[model samples]
Target chain A: MDKLKAIIESLLFASDAPLTIDKIKSILETEDRKTINNLLVSLTNEYDSQKRGFFLSEVAGGYQLRTRPEHRHWTRKIRLMKPARLSRPALETLAIIAYKQPVLRSDIEHLRGVDSGGTLHTLLARGIIRVLGRKDLPGRPVVYGTSKRFLELFDLRDLNSLPTLKDLQDLGQEWPNDSK
Target chain B: MKEQLKNKSESPYEVQLGETFEGPMDLLLHLVKKNEVDIYDIPVAMIMEQYMEYLKLMRIMNIDVAGNFLVMAATLAQIKSRMLLPVDEEQEEDEEDPRMELVRPLEEYLQIKYAAEDLAVRNRLDWDVFTRNVSEDTEACEKQDQEFVNISLFELIDAFQKIVKRVSSKHFMDITVDTISVNARISEVADLLEQHDSVSFQELLEGQDTKGQLIVTFLAILEMAKSQIIRIMQHVESGIIRIFNG
Candidate 1:
């Protein structure tokens, strides 16, 4: 591999979180984002072609080297991993906040037709959702939105990568995406 | 009817229902799917009857269905009654169907439910995939093992209750004067903190002879915490709040 490609790989390997293009460029003492991005792409493709135990994943607005899902059984034997488990209600609440953010608590409750206070608290504690600010309405209820941790946990490239309403047709009925 | 209402205990069926349904809209969606009805058109009267029957079953099972469910029931009843009235010919062009109110939210809920399912199956960082984070792994494990959380007001109040219970039993009839004021207790706490690096809440109230003195100590600690004079933290394993000079 070239020196730049090797450096990018080393950076991704050393870092605990995803490494963005800008971060790599700054570390390389260069301003050419394009070259850095190209090197990252080539390195990612090389790893894929090599059929390595891990692959490059684009997540949370950056690139990360993650072990392939199939290798989990053997890799997990080395150490205990306490996976963060989210309840169904928590997931539903996260979905609402993910799509309709900075949504009010009342908006979520109105959609679910239930009290979502407990689920909201769980999501907040899990660090996937966050309080953006208080709304400008009466009582000044807190508004919420998804966090970068949410994107990482969901393996999403960004908020736009969330499955649109059209993708849900296989699960059930299809409706026009007129929600504003 | 009266006998069922009088006995307030959870039935086995209530647990089953509680686990099955997340909320009233979830139950409604389940009903719609079970009946194979279209979303745009719903048989309001029939669904209302079944909805009320479910509520009645909850009542019989002694499950306190939340207020939101009752609110939905009232909404369903209102929609049913409105559907019963004659159609206004003049406003027919603009007045949307009353069922649309329920349909819109149900459709939105269903969309989000599927999205949640999609999110659930994604490649989670720790569960499905691993990263080259050997150093971070050890650091995270150490963090999990010895985590200290900030003590909340409720925890402080709980500690106070224990202190009160412990002191009240022995000094039930003793009428002591309020000699130890809050200001005096504050200085005493400050002096103790100056001497020791840290002190547990129980240790601070160790030798209080009267309930009034304990109350003063608790108030002084609260005031200190509010003024940023002392930091209150509790260990996850021991659950003991310790005071530190801020």
Candidate 2:
């Protein structure tokens, strides 16, 4: 059982993205999901109790080993990829699209109260949002929806993993809107 | 405000076009908060005055205020004019408040903005945590030095647009002649791939003289990519696309 846990750990370490339990089971040629689940739980607890440099995180509906945030300073030294960032306007536009998708560009523009053509183009180029074909209405405007890459980039298990709008509203109420 | 404007030597548009100026609604929201007014029963007369004052300031300073702002200004004026008219007692029972138009969208914008703020703080993939990365594929390990993003359809269109612009500008005398069919171009691209390990996207369009040839070649590339005959990859740093045999 310990050897199996180690093998699972190795698999998680070697895989590029998150590794699903089904994927692990398929690779290991096993039908026992319970045993694999038990092994993953033990591995997670072991890493936690040991206070290792990294820990297993459940993201995008699978398990991925990620470096701790506390070690980010040192991680920066060896980080090869450029840090990706989205501007405030872009994030606002993306949020509207993510929450209300299969949405037309006109809807996004109306909610944002700005012309979102450039931001939409940027998001589409980055593959964060995808064209979900045309709406059945007149002019047949191109509708957009969040892509799988959006979920992956945001570390969400699925769209349902997004925080509820009510939660955000409650949080917003707590803050004073003095920052102009 | 005048003193602050004097301190900045740059153009007014440059000074104000940063992350601060989100849109006309953002300015309205700012005014609402600054005045500490209720969103439900907004002091539209005052808010509209302040909104136009900002617009006037922008105009005086020669700031290129967006057309949306002007549209909002007109909306505010219309609402103000409606508010000035005598209330019709019979229609008042059926008519809704004019301010509701502005308030509804503002409330919706606020909710979405809050959602955006919430999203900004989540455990983002690259920002908060670094995942362990290893090449899961073994066959295509030849180009290990640089990472490649799968070229998106929109990016391909952008590249194609650039090609069209270049071809049209240089080949001014070239007539619209269907010299090569899309099928012929596909076979030509496949044969070219057979001869070379990889080819730059620009190199494939090197000898295509006519506008029709360029369009046909682009369509062939798209078809081949769709059929998995070739892979289109853009370098992470340079953004140069190269086609490889699939």
Candidate 3:
């Protein structure tokens, strides 16, 4: 178990990007993904227990080592990077895509009553949203939807965890209406 | 504040918009909320006139009112015209409300706007939970041109695809491959490169055209490139790749 943990650690350390469970398993020539899954958890726990300068985290759909947030000030002093800067328009476009996924671009333009060509391009370039396919309408307009990276970016467990209209309303902690 | 500013201007056409980022829907939603009107039951004529009046101010302030705003204005006018006339009793039973066309989109837009605001908050919170970034993107100056040291595996595959596409048309019959290894093809590519100082990507797959052969050749090319046995360089942007002996 100790040797296995060390091997996984070195594998992660050598990797420049996050390694998914399948990736780790393939490299280690392991069969059961669950065994490796446990080892990853144990490694994270061990890191947390030791209060290490860096910790393994599941980001962008894979495991990668990242510095502790407390130590980010030092990194920031060196270089301040705000990757994926979502402007106001981009965020609005993203929100619409999230709520009504598989939505047509024409429908988005109609809803916003504005040209979304640039905003859509920005979101695509950032890899937050992608063209799911063309809608089965006239001209077969492109449909947009949030990507898996969107889920990871928002730190959401899944799409179902997205805040619905009711979620927004009940954010004030209101009781469900019984009289209506 | 806009009202006070409008009064001082002594011009009915003058209007002050709060910020540059407000979209047409954002403005309409703002009006809907301020009026506390039910989204399902928007007063179209009243809202349309108010919307037009706001546009007057937007125009006075030299704010670029996109055609979408005017389209909505036209839509509102059409809805208003529809509302002015009484519907027949039979038609009213199965008829859709004139205001529904505008109301539905507004409700959806407002919902998403709120959600986006919520997401912005969550995104800030997400930043607190940092992850390891091995890219070292910010280690140097932020605005420096990218150092294209190592190309992505996908980029290499794309280049290989272009080469295979050129060859596939020539050999159309061979699809089934009983035996062909990527490692074997790697040596083949190396030997081919040894014969020439530099080879265009197409020359490497001179004879191989089948899907199986194309794939194997692609794998071999990628393997050699990774092992530093060959250098894949494009003489120009979006041009043919040249494989150089490493």
Candidate 4:
């Protein structure tokens, strides 16, 4: 059981992406579903008690080990080697793209009240956002969404974890409306 | 009172104000204002000292000062040291003002800061108006009721692939055909349906030697139906199709 737990922990830690229970079971060749569930629970408690920099959470139908939000600042600083300052236009554009993802460049431009074509290109080059797909419309404009790297940088669990307009207003922005 | 004064002086760079300084430049500007130094002729040495002091204070308080702050400290030290050096004739003759070069970044930083503040204000006000308009516009587009449901093309392809795989796994004898036209197969199936008035979809799929041949025949039948070469009748609930020769 100790060996099984260690193997599960190591597998979870090493994976760059989430791993489902079925995949884990298949890899381990163990039919003991109850043991795996108990091991996961114990590991979660151990990490919680130890106050480790990482924690395991289920997301997108799989378990993933991620850096705790509190440790994000130091991890980001260490990884980046320096703080990158974003321009106002870039920040605003990023905010808009993040909240209204799978949106078109034209729609983003319409929202921002400025020409965001260059900014979008810069963001794409930076790998902060990506072209998700082309909208099935007359013009067939490309849709954009924030990348996994964006979530990593922002320390967000998912898009739904983003601060709502009400949260932004509470943080001292002006009017609040949950548009997207 | 004297002991308290000493304690305060020892912690001269105490972070009394809120930690939110917007950016490194904002913090530098705040330090400049606190020192009552002119923005144009910023006392680089004094500012650098204060900046370092603030960083130390932040460190002592266990506040994680971002790398940008440290970078600004390095830049200030570089500028201050440069200012202390005697300028040679070759360097002095350069068109750009040394002070202007130093202050240009500050001006740019301030401009960006104010621009962000302005944008934040606009986003708040404009979002409300945009949401109202969007709700009204989308009210007419009730077609979105069906559109929002998740249906991936990959899932459809996977289902088709599974069907093909299952059909291939079943052992069957290979049949070589010199002139078995798809038109003949379609007409035969249609005629069988016409005779029986109804036939199982599974019955139609059987007797094929390979999965590839079965898929090809099925696609041909579908193409003919699309072109109105044959009419397909089906019960609403049961997805079973009955082909009719038209």
Best by lDDT: 2
What ranking emerges by TM-score with the best candidate at the front? 1, 2, 3, 4
* Candidate 4: pairs in clash: none
Please, what are the lDDT tens digits per residue for candidate 3 over residues A1-180? 889989999989878656788998898898989888899999999899999987777765678776676775454444455343455567778888988898888777777666778789878876789999987788888899998778766656567777777668557222211010
Residue runs of model 4 more than 4 Å from their true location after superposition = A18-23, A30-38, A57-80, A83-86, A170-180, B1-246
**In model 2, what is the error at residue B110, expressed in angstroms?**
0.6
Runs in model 1 deviating more than 4 A are A76-78, A166-180, B1-21, B88-92, B134-246
lDDT of 4 by residue, B1-246 (tens): 123223223323322211112335556766665678877888888888877866764454323466666677778877887787788878677834455755876654443334334333331211111111111111111111111122111222233344556775544234333323455667777677668754544556655555434543554454454344544444334534444443
Off by over 4 Å in 3: A46-56, A67-78, A99-103, A131-141, A145-152, A156-180, B1-20, B81-97, B123-127, B134-246
Candidate 4 lDDT at B80 equals: 80
Q: Quality of candidate 1's docking, in CAPRI categories? A: acceptable
Query: Interface RMSD of candidate 3?
Result: 11.6
- Per-residue C-alpha lDDT of model 1 across residues A5-52, encoded as one tens digit per residue: 888888999888888888887888889998888888897888889998
Query: All models: lDDT?
Result: 0.72, 0.73, 0.64, 0.54
For residues B1-246, what per-residue lDDT tens digits would candidate 1 score against the true structure?
334223222212222223213568876775676577897899999888977877775554334577778888998999999998988899889888899989988878888877776777787777677777632212121112125555544346557667767765566334344446566789999999999877899988867766545655776787677565777778778887888875
Candidate with more favorable, higher lDDT: 2 or 3 = 2
lDDT of 3 by residue, B1-246 (tens): 233223323322211222213457766765576577877888877788778877774453334466767777888899999988899888898888988888777767666666777676663312444554523211233322122122333235446556656654546453443435666777777787678666776666656656555555655665566455766656444555667775
Q: Which digits, one per residue and each the tens of the lDDT, describe model 2 over residues B168-219?
A: 5456344433456667889999999999877888888756886556655776
- Please estimate how well model 1 matches the true structure, expressed as its whole-model Cα lDDT: 0.72
Individual DockQ of the candidates? 0.29, 0.26, 0.14, 0.02
lDDT of 4 by residue, A32-118 (tens): 888888888898888889997767765445666666656543443333122232344566567777776788987765444345677
**Clash numbers, per candidate:** 0, 0, 2, 0
